[model samples]
Target: MTVSSTSPSAQSSATRTQTSAAVSVSSETALPTSETKQAILTQPLFVYNPEYIAFLNKSLATRSPEEILEWALISLPGLVQTTAFGLTGLVILDMINKIRNRRQLAEHPVPLIFIDTLYHFQETLDVAKRASEKYDAPLQVYHPQGHDNVASFESHHGQELWKTDADVYDYVVKVEPGRRAAIENNAQVLITGRRRSQGASRAAIPILEIDSGVTPAVLKLNVLADWDYARVWKYVQENGVPYNVLHDRNYKSIGDWHSTQPTAESEGERDGRWKGEAKTECGLHKDYFKMRANYLAAAKKRKLTESTDFVLVDSEEPSSKKIDS
Candidate 1:
């Protein structure tokens, strides 16, 4: 699919409100009851909420990356800044610290959330430590329940699950745990450093958004949705922001050690990730429907294999029924 990238300047308040109202209209029309809205308000916004996409699109349209960041801080009072310890997100954190410093919001600075897939690089862990200290903000880390470390994970699910079953690996490592963490933390909004120029999947990203079924919150801000690689680098240089050292080695996007790879000068960034595959995200920011469909496809394939094996076993049974006359 040819996806178009939207810059934040393309959004307007009128457009945002109208889009939100349209969502409200569609939602109410579908439900035909005030009680439904109330019920939905309590649940994740994206579950049935239309405004989530509206906001994502609008914010990315109207504001600059920096402006979107400011709005995220202002719009979501109970916002939680989340990241997979990637380069782009770190830039947001750097800017956030600067904003907080200038505004004297140090006492209640925004907190950072990490999924801690337990397969990250030592450098990533070290960067997390350095970042937490630098920002002087609360750091909440979450990991998969059963698998606490890499060795444990490998022992449970043979090594190279990414190659064998990438979707499952993504769901367990990134998607589900992220949802749980946000919910448990009682987050009203989430701030991500996702930018449109990153890849095919994220091209149409909006700046301000609701998480739809993915998150219970009313808003999930992609504060830098429009930022290109050049702008990101420029911002970092201008602010003297500390970043993960991996970027120097052509690792544009950083994730768990097993999943990420460096890009070559000619191949373009994001090449190493999901190499030889059309996949971009690791079941994180894409729509819930897509993620579910992928999971189901993988599950069905596995089931089919099992069914075939069962048939073969039954056929191979020696004289079980005396040739079944």
Candidate 2:
């Protein structure tokens, strides 16, 4: 599963060629504004037309995951894989490695982005490190802003913040970090691990989707959207991909430690995640605008409460001083 690294000189030459190609395309395109032209030159070319997207989904529905991935590597620029080191994600990572080998690529064509969330199990983190090294994939890890460890996070946000305010907690830990990772990496197309077998919102996902939730909307490629749990597992076992050891303990879908649990064999794959709650997809896949709005509102209310408490405490201190005098 090793993809050799390209020489620095070769990478620079490739970059220059890509930049020149983008400039040529921008010149030919009749963009209305200079800003639009600049954007086209800087970002990967993607058509947001609904008709084209629909056609792509219809055409790709019957393709194998490997075929879909190979197509994506060639067609999509700024491509990256976002994973939690889950089984399905591991399978995709392995497949991408094989594809890179087949194409005789100097390095893994697609990079990987992993949002730590600062609350994942130790086993998950271990798998992330092991998988990245084994696949020789470029891995970029992101976590919540200003908080490196659980203790620091708790000191500011309070203990068990998920229980106190689930939405805010998720926004700070997972959604915000995940968004930051994509933006920082300039990712235009994201290879995700979601499959229809997971059920809920994922049951009807298309092979390709325009995720307009982020500031700069990105393409979400569900290469394995049509794959089932058994198929995914088979690939994992056959490829000997590294995965979270918790899966062997019946923890089907792993996320934050507090919210995740082991499920019964009869339960759905994601039943272990957010147990007893209706939250299937974390804020990462939800409407980014809505999540941001909710987080800002909650933050504002908390700040106001803190300010009022400070005023109350200051007034009480004056009264206590007067009494002492």
TM-score of each: 0.71, 0.79
What Cα-based lDDT does every candidate model obtain? Answer: 0.62, 0.71
Backbone clash tally (model 2): 0
- Across 1-325, the per-residue lDDT of candidate 1 in tens digits comes to 0111344433457866754444222111221123443353366432313434555555346555554555455433456777876768878887777656666553434657787787888889888877777777667776654555778777655688777888777766676567666666556677887777776867876665545556545566777777788888887778777778988888877877876899887775677787777887777675655665676576576552221111222233321111000
lDDT tens string, model 2, 1-325?
0112332332244654553343222213332233443464386444454544665677677677887877666555667688898998999999988876765666666657787778889999888888888988767776676666788777778888888888888788877767766665556778889999899999998998877675243688998898888888888888788889998999888988888899998999999888888788787888877877887788798762321111222232211110000
Pick out the ten consecutive residues of candidate 1 with the lowest summed lDDT: 316-325
Q: Distance from true position, residue 212, model 2, in Å?
A: 3.2
Error of 2 at 221 (Å): 0.2
**RMSD to truth, every model:** 13.5, 13.7
lDDT of 1: 0.62
The prediction achieving the highest lDDT against the true structure is 2
